[model samples]
Target: MKTTILPLAALGIALAVPGHAAAKSGDVQFKLLGTLVAPDGKITSVKKDLIGLPAGTQTKADDNVVPTVAIEYFLTDAISVETIAGVTQHDVDGRGALAGAGLVSNAKIVPATLTLKYHFGKDGGIQPYVGAGPSYYIFIDEKPGATAVALGATRQKMNDKVGAALQAGIDVPINDKGLALSVDVKRYFLRTTAHWYAGPTEVLTTRHKLDPWVISAGAAFRF
Candidate 1:
């Protein structure tokens, strides 16, 4: 799990940034990135298992690639704030004792995040940055997989949760026209509960680790 703390840390960064903010002050940068979402959906505990799950059952979420957009505003040449928008989908399958079992299907996630970054170098050169902030994972349109359906699971739900994120990346300038190539990676620490229901009755409940790595690379436009 990421110990990056919470979103409130963004409030304290102004006092820590170096005094060289005049060059890129008030600048805005827009980026269109191709992102990869890789998550670990391993079951941590089975709170309720009415369906008689076998011993040592585990789960793993699949990876996904999607298009994402990032918008950033520079408070100074060295410090900036950013947010991203995108949707990712995944599927969880059984492992260990539950090998070959399908657990969840087409789970969509909206990783709502905000970060405060500190760029390392001055303008007209390659710059590296590190950031941290809060994250809210919104789950949507999740359905039970074939194995669960066969075992009498009529519906499924994954709860929304608040978490933290840590990020590190770099930006390389292409020219003097505010064009750049950027690469970024973020790791989010999150946990949530999964519930399975049969018509009007709740049948099972489990806790899962949802730590995900988000990697992105693409063109950036700064003005």
Candidate 2:
């Protein structure tokens, strides 16, 4: 009689389990997102010229729109590891004295970030999360623009950078089929060194602080 009762109790418990519990432990999530990267930092020229030019010539980078993707593996219901990748292009121009001179240079950046996230939620409801991690950026196709060419700048190059990344976002379940809509904002503290030929004989060097905020929104799938 005890064995018959035990089996019935197990069956009832299984039937009462919520379907959203499928994302509980050891789940992997994939997201395809669109991102806007807006630069919010300054660029300063470090090497002062012999002609006694200003000590810190400043510049600003323009904002960009790009496509991004992220993959997350849940270590537990509240903890996960995520990696995000995206490619973006930006136009850099001078400020202050060189302002309105048009584009100084253009560069394509591919950034990959790995983060550990902490999420707050129960099974299938809205999940809000925060993450922090490190990001690696590869700068490619650094080319001189019209302004740079007019200033006799040639062979421009931007150094690759590694920086800290911070993120915050929420995931709202759209249906019971392991699908959710996600929105997140991330900031990166990135700095890089720039080298270019001011002329056929002169090489100009500077350091740029390219702290950018990335806002993303998209759909995610949990399995």
Candidate 3:
């Protein structure tokens, strides 16, 4: 009878294991995925006078669309860290109305960001998150036409920018492995000191303000 009772007790313990696992499913996990960032923002600039000409003018930096790839890691049930990188290309219209001379130029800016995020969800429902952080920008490949009266149009190299970021998003789960679809929006506030070398007799510098808003939709996986 003792031998019979031992086998029955073992079967009962085996059946209880699934219940224990279900209770512990709350353990932490990591997530990895590819995301796309579409940025929409306005550019404004401050100009200074040159050669006794009334310079010191501040104008819009130019408008453009930039694309990027993002990565994020979740540290706990409600916290995460993320990074995004991409390049931006835009055109300066030489203050069209200010310069009836018809001048236009192009500039390229690349932005990279790091953020801390907080997530919300209960019982595996839809999770929404928000993030705030800092961004670093690099300006390159600037070309301004000779007719550009804004000073150092072609001679300017606005290589660096520093700013802050604000973001919000939601994720919809698809399975137990933590596969989900995500949608997010972000805003970056930044500025740059634009400098140009115009021939041997001219060098110009200006301060620019750039604020870009980005919206992204993509798929994510958790491990």
Candidate 4:
């Protein structure tokens, strides 16, 4: 009886040791990813005083795919902090009454997000996570298109934005060396003001709500 108990106790410890040593504190992970930015929200004009425009004008942004990168530092086996950086360019066009008028404007958006993540499961398997935090958006290189130029608009601008972000992802281990494949999705709740100019005059100002959802898949290396 005593000999049988000793072997069973050793087997239990062996099974637990590998998982405990796999992911611990002070581990760093880096991921190189491809992200698809899809705009699932509407852009409504606060002021529609321009000619041939109706009240409550709205528009939609086009979808785009871009390269992204993320770095995560594990505080524990189950908790981590992650930072993500990416740049996406979007073409804004008229929806509803503004459809088929070509592009209204094009703008480049760079979002830097910091999140606190909670990871589930033990080692040697899939690690699923959920995260939430804040994001800072930098809007640059805005250009007015044919539709805006025809309306006597010379310049277009989008204000920089700061908003909340929510994220979820899963990581599948590829080997024992801490290399993994990651699939992630994140959403940004953002709103900003769009400024249209004719020479030195600010002709149109409207509130633009751009809640963009990002889906990403890539590889991660843990060290």
Candidate 5:
């Protein structure tokens, strides 16, 4: 009779289990992700002597796919914090008759973001959330390699940047063990001042606005 009662209690607990859900008090997650960024506009440089290029010197921005890794810690079932990092490369093209004369070089932008997110609907195996936070950008590899300048070179000066980020995502849980798949989208509003140094003879400067859209897909696990 005692053995029969113990087996019955264990069966009841199993039958009473509910749908997949996040942890109640504390959980940590790690994820690997990739993002596709679409640059909103052409690259504009504000420097002295750069405006004199041939009318056909075409300047444009490039949108490339980037991969990232992030880690998150959940304070409660409803709230979490995450940090992610990614980078992309871009090139300036020379076109028209002045194609040979304008600055054509490569540069990169690296962004690191810290986000705070709010989760919703965790009891049904589908969790959706929205988040907002701040980001830091570092510009590198600025070289005046080639173009039509008195010194046959050009240089870009970009300041370290601070900006705002917003993101939304949904997670699909696979089981009670906290394994899930996620899809997310994020946008950043960033501003920068570009300065170009063209040889000893010239300099140019311009203020530009950068609003980048990013889409990501990844897998996550809770511990």
Candidate 6:
């Protein structure tokens, strides 16, 4: 009987706390962010390789910086949903036994993502959040590298794929108004199939892991 009463009393006190729901429901936030995209474009397996590949051949994708925007809406004081818009470009280059070889050049991707976030803290103070959600990676305008073209490959294609992202971030209030400083980080897990064709014949095919770390910092406005 005492334990039950103690628990109920604690809940009542917590609910009565001041500024508990400082970020009210139906609030909207807009952020303009500078984002860094760093991907692991390593070869996971060779499905088909007509063009001979050296033993222990590996690959890496170079990083890029891009401008991004995020829109968020609060469902409750502690829960919100957010989506981001951005396009980034990357280049996959050979490593290990096939060093200095370019495999795919100027591969652009639209990382479409939506997340449901749970936030902690009041509106006039620091709020930290964690989120997770599904993602789709759209590949565009990827060209066969110079080496691939020289090696009888004239075209390259990377298949679009479904993926997931885990996110964590913090929003720090700048003033009494609805302005904040925001920093966010997300880890994406995804894979894609690469195809290289020589004219009409498919010459090379491989599977690659494109797990990328995305970091962002920007100013946020809420109303």
- Stretches of candidate 6 above 4 Å error? 1-21
In TM-score terms, candidate 2 sits at: 0.85
Query: TM-scores, in order shown?
Result: 0.89, 0.85, 0.68, 0.87, 0.76, 0.89
- lDDT per residue as tens, model 5, 28-139: 8877777787655344553445456444444444577878777888888789998887777655444455454334345587887899999987364467899999988777
Q: Model 1, clash count? A: 0
Q: In model 5, where do residues sit more than 4 Å from their true spots?
A: 1-19, 43-59, 92-104, 144-151, 200-202
Model 2: per-residue lDDT, tens digit, 106-140? Answer: 68999889999999865656788999999998998
**Which parts of model 1 are misplaced by more than 4 Å?**
1-23
Instruction: Mark the 10 consecutive residues where model 4 has the least summed lDDT.
Output: 12-21
Clashing pairs in 4: none
Best by the lDDT measure: 6
Candidate 1 is scored at a TM of 0.89
- Tell me the deviation in Å of residue 175 in model 3: 3.7
Sorting all predicted structures by lDDT, with the top scorer first, yields 6, 1, 4, 2, 5, 3
- For model 6, residues 1-223, the per-residue Cα lDDT tens digits are 9999999878655534344235779999999999999999999999998878999999999999999999999999899999999999998999999888888999999999999999986444578999999999999999998888889888999999999999999987766567778999999999999999999999889999999999999999888
Choose the strongest candidate by TM-score.
6
Select the stronger candidate by TM-score from 3 and 6: 6
C-alpha local distance difference test of each model: 0.88, 0.80, 0.60, 0.82, 0.69, 0.91
Candidate order by TM-score, highest to lowest? 6, 1, 4, 2, 5, 3
Model 3 ranges with Cα > 4 A deviation: 1-47, 51-58, 99-104, 145-154, 201-203
lDDT of 4 by residue, 1-223 (tens): 9999999878655544243235678999999999999974366556645544664457778899999999999998789999988889987887777775544456898998999999986565567899999999898898877888887888888899899899999987776778788999999899888778889887777777788889999999889
> Which should have the higher TM-score, number 2 or number 5?
2
Candidate 4: residue 191 Cα off by (Å): 0.7
Root-mean-square deviation of every model: 9.7, 8.2, 11.3, 5.7, 8.5, 5.9
